[model samples]
Target: MSRVFVKKASYDNLDQLIAEIFTLYDINLRGKRVLIKPNMLGAFPPEHGNCTDPRLVAAVVREVRKQTDRIWVGDNPMRVQAGGGVDDSARISGIYEASQGYYVNVGAKARVISIGSEIIAQMPVSEYFLEADAIINLPKAKTHMIAGITCCVKNMFGAVVGSAKAKIHYDAGHAKRFTQFLVDLYKYFKPTLNIVEALTIMEGDGPTHGKIREGGKIIAGTSGVEVDAVVASMMGFQLNRLKFLQLASQAGLGECDLGKIEVVGDFEPWPNFELPSTYSGRPMDNIQVAQAAEIHEVWGQVGRLHPRFIEENCTACGSCAEICPAGAIALDPYPVVDEAKCVSCFCCAEVCPEAALVMPKEEAQTLFLRLNPQIREG
Candidate 1:
């Protein structure tokens, strides 16, 4: 059984919380090549709960400094706004200062590797990520439009640099396949430890943009799968509803069985935490390739919830169209989605800094059916 150490903490006492986990476990940081991957989605502030709190990351750096000086902190953040790169996002998110300029654009260079997934056969992973001896995954707890929740598992997508990430989404063409790809990627490129910052989390629609809710929690563990499972539970999601967690467990990577997990602190569900509008609480069955393909063709009809562009909020920056996985979104001087080709992945919404994209409540919920769980998906 994998052990997960969770502690109730505020951002102010982050070091003490992290220190407690170190005390509970034998997580050796002495003279190790440590790579810290923090959730730097874009240039969003920590208060918005869109990115990992840099203060918490700084605490991790301080803890490791006690053991070694060989440390590199970095992440390939999505270009959400015009004229902003990973450096901008890192700075705005406070990771740049927290890391003391140790932050690197790890995605700047890449090396191709076989992922062994049917949809994503191979990908160009960051060379720096592959070379690291000990990896500390710093993830912000948030709801993901596609993956249910973006924690330890979805955070690893940063390993794939540049436009290659969109290509995998296009290739997978389905949530189940995409989630399996994440599981496979974790199996191949994994971290040494998983630490989650749930002090403030994006609850409604996130990974990038959403409402901030105070969780006042810090969770740490060795297994990403186990850590993610616990986060899902905290967010009020059932294990089977999380495709990546289900796939990860099925792939023999980690255990999602609550009975088998060893938790080290207080555990309780966050009250009324809002899940994404399109999140179906129904459990997923076994991942048979043929079944996944069949589900892909018909899954969107239930919600048909695709993001509509708001011209007022749009800056004509073209980042959304560029980041669109299926190439379904195009710039006609403004961005437009080709409904026939679109898969409703909402990747555009994540990269849109202008907050121009929106899913209509009327569209997500019909008169006869509330296709979404709530009145609003966002």
Candidate 2:
């Protein structure tokens, strides 16, 4: 039976909780190559809940250091070929300081690994993941625009290096198929342990731009799927509608049923937690979205994941254009994107410094358009 351990904790009190996890479980990390993969969704600070808390990461490293000297913390940041690499995110998010010089640039080197799935057969994984004997995944408990909830299962997407991610997303254009791809990825590159950083969680539009909520909890488990199941349930997500969790459960990856999982500590669910808007209109019983053309053909002739530029927030950094896999974005007087060429991968948004690229839901955009009659008329 899979066990999910919930520890009531704040960033300051993480040591005790981490200690409990080690004491509770029979995990052996002594003298082994360990990779600490944190939820590094670009380069946002811990308080924003956009990425994994550096404090939590440092704490994990300290604990892991007690057992092994061969430990490295790394993540392949969502950037274009010319933009900042993992170190930039590490420096910005304070993860580099937390890593204490063991930080690695995941995109620096990679080894292609097979997902063993027909949808996405081969992918280049970060060398850290390939090299590690034991992986300790520290994912932030936050709602993602794409996968719904980016916990244990979704965090593994960082394994695929740089622009290759865009290709993978392009492959799984439909939301449901993309969710299944995540499950398959997790199942392929399964983490040894998962500890969720939920002290400050992202509530509204996230894995990046969102509102912060203080749920004040730390969740841990041996199986990534089981930990995510408990966390998703705690966040008041209906399992039937949550495609990632449902797919993971259906794949026999881990037990999503609350009855099957053993909760080790007190769990308080966030009833009013605001989920993202990607839940509706996805891969259904008959919807076939295998090609990019199908995406534009599906919803009002525009792709589901539309990358819109927030003019006020944009500083003309040209990072978006530089990083766009399709070269759909061009830096004119501002940034002009060729919608037809864009794959809706959200990489441009991921690398932006000013949080300028906001991918609002289609309905939300329509409502905004309605509010501004001039823009609507134009």
Candidate 3:
């Protein structure tokens, strides 16, 4: 059975708590090239709850230092602009300082590898990630627009370098395919250890752009899939609703069934934890279908389905136009989408810092019912 350890912690006591966890998990890093991967999603500050807490990163780095001095801490954030890279993101999130002078710009160098997924045949991955003897995955406990919740398993997507992430979203075309791609990627490059920063988590709608809540917990395990299973339960998300977790479990990646796993210490599910606006906690046999219907392909027959831009929230930063793989968006003083050229990838929505670009969920249940004639609304 997979084992997960949960502890209620604070930044003041994190270093001691992490050292204890490392010992309990028996994570050995002596004389090894170790890469510490943290959730540096963008240039957002820690208080925003977008990236992993810098204090958590610092604690992990110190523990790793006890065994090995050869350590690198980094992640490839979504490229919102032309010149912005991992260094800018790391510094802004205070991860560079917290890394204790071990931060490396992972996006600077990459090596191409064969992914062999249905979405893409080959892709670029970070050289630092590939050269590591062991990878310590540090993911924030947060809601994601696409994956419902991005914890241990979804965090591995940072292994892909630069704009290739947007391209992968474009190739996958919708939520179901994209989720499958995530499972495939995780299986290929599974981390040696998984640790989640649940002390502060994002809700409402995230990975970015969500309200912060006090989770007051840290979860750790060797299996990313199993760790994510525990996180989903803590957030009050039905295991069936997260398709990627189900797929990962089916692929024999780890035991996703909570009953089958071993849980250690002070685990209590949060009461009334808010989920993403896109998810309604409805009952459905095909959860992937529900996700696709709500987020990506609303007007299936009509080809005009695209992201709705919130003009007031936009900064005219041109991030949407820059990240569009199809070049479908143009800045006419403000952004405008050319319906015919748009691929409905939602890459624009993902890269929008201000939450300006969003999927339409005004009448989600009605629209989903209309689009899927066979599947009845819950």
**CA-only RMSD, every prediction:** 5.1, 6.4, 3.1
* Candidate 3 Cα lDDT to native: 0.81
- Candidate with better lDDT, 2 vs 3: 3
Candidate 1 scores a C-alpha RMSD against the true structure in Å of 5.1
Which candidate order results from sorting by TM-score in descending order? 3, 1, 2
Best by lDDT: 3
Tens-digit lDDT track of model 1 for 1-378 = 789877888878988878777767677988788899998888877666788999889999988788888888989865633336877788888898999757788877789988676768788888888888888899999987667788998888888886677778778877777878888888777888889988888876676767788888998888999999888888877676566777798888788877778887878889877775445332132111212222334456653457878999888988888888777888988998898888877778878887798654344323113322222231
- The TM-score of predicted model 3 comes to 0.91
Q: For residue 23, what is the lDDT in candidate 3?
A: 91
Residue 101 miss distance in model 1 (angstroms): 3.5
Which ten residues in a row are the worst by lDDT in model 1?
A: 285-294
Shift of residue 165 alpha carbon in model 2, Å: 1.1
Residue 14's lDDT in candidate 2: 81
> lDDT per model, in order?
0.76, 0.74, 0.81
- The digit string of per-residue lDDT tens for model 3 on 265-307 reads 9799977777664564332321233554233544455343477
* lDDT pick, better of 1 and 2: 1
